[model samples]
Target: MKKISLYHTEIENKDGISGHVRSLTDDAFNQLTSSPLKSVPGTNPEQLLGAALATCLNATLEAEEKRRNLPHQAIVRVAVDMGRDYQGFQFWLRVQVKLPQVDQQEAQEILAICEQRCPVAKLLAKSQNVKIELVNEFGFKEEFK
Candidate 1:
């Protein structure tokens, strides 16, 4: 498939402790800094990564749901853990997706498709460990890795 879109962002960092990020969209400006425990108030790369993955995966799932005529409300929470690994720095993700309009089997199916379709999920899962939990209205839950 040919690429249809390209997104750009720039991060200005000096001391590795504080920085600013700018993307093509004017509303995408963000103040970047180390974790609160390590520095002053601001956002860190891990937080931004988690946020981006959550939003991107949610959008992908929304599109799939629309295409499949499966209307549902959902909340996706993504947690990113950053630490040192044998190869150097590494990160992992814990994602929980709550769906109000599907059963466990259906939710799992939808999430499986989303995992294959979401670009962020694809990229991250290639190099980072990603764990996803899907929950439905009946309280049924399933996990994927």
Candidate 2:
């Protein structure tokens, strides 16, 4: 097997409420809560997760189509619902994929392969816990232990 690539991002907060996320490419995004009443301006973690899953799934689907030489393109939308369960936090995702040039059966087959091929989807299927690092501006870092 070929070597895999590692993607990294750093989320830094001076206070506990708001912060910024910086990717390895130096792309910076402001991070904050999505509550309308408390309305802080920025993208929340849930939104980022949804975007990642949706993009990865769509890319996988396109790759599958290319392997099969099936001239098709898809519009993929993922809705991620985050709530609290008995174990604390739980996430539910609804993936809606629309393949315009293909029939329902072909679409189903593509979706099945995409689900298996998408790394994020496969990881989420097993309910794995991700390790997160909380770093303060004072250079103190804490990892989830």
Candidate 3:
């Protein structure tokens, strides 16, 4: 099979978790980054990771919904927790998906399919720290391990 590049971009961060992050491919894509432990006005890696997964997974679900002739009403919520483990600091991501227009069984089916199709979800699929769930309603709160 031939490899084709559909989209590509680069991001740079010089200050680790306390300064700025900018995209090399897009001039308008610049933002401040800070540690979640601090009360600073910036975004952290955890939030960014959550945003990526939620956005990508929901976009995949949108495509599937379109294909099924349904309205785009899928919601994705990702909660990222950072903690210390045996190997030092580790991250856990809890991804919850809600398809309000469908039944529980069908929503679960769509979530399973989307998990295999979403690029970000697929990238994190093998990690034992990541979990994807189909939810009837979002609580938006979770106890981290």
* Candidate with maximal TM-score: 3
Candidate 3: list runs displaced more than 4 Å.
none
Please give the distance, in angstroms, between residue 41's alpha carbon in candidate 2 and its true position after superposition: 0.9
Q: Which digits, one per residue and each the tens of the lDDT, describe model 1 over residues 55-111?
A: 999998899788889884767888777767788777777888986788788888888
* C-alpha local distance difference test of each model: 0.75, 0.64, 0.92
TM-score-sorted candidate list, best first: 3, 1, 2
State the displacement of the C-alpha of residue 19, model 2, in Å, after optimal TM-score superposition. 1.5
Give TM-scores for every candidate, taking all chains together and pairing residue i with residue i. Answer: 0.76, 0.67, 0.94
After superposing candidate 1 on the true structure, give the runs of residues whose Cα lies further than 4 Å from its correct spot.
6-15, 24-27, 136-145
Looking at candidate 3, the ten consecutive residues that score lowest on lDDT are 136-145
Which number leads on lDDT? 3
lDDT of 1 at 5: 64
Question: lDDT, candidate 2, residue 115?
Answer: 79
| Pairs of residues at least 3 apart in sequence or in different chains that clash in candidate 1 | none
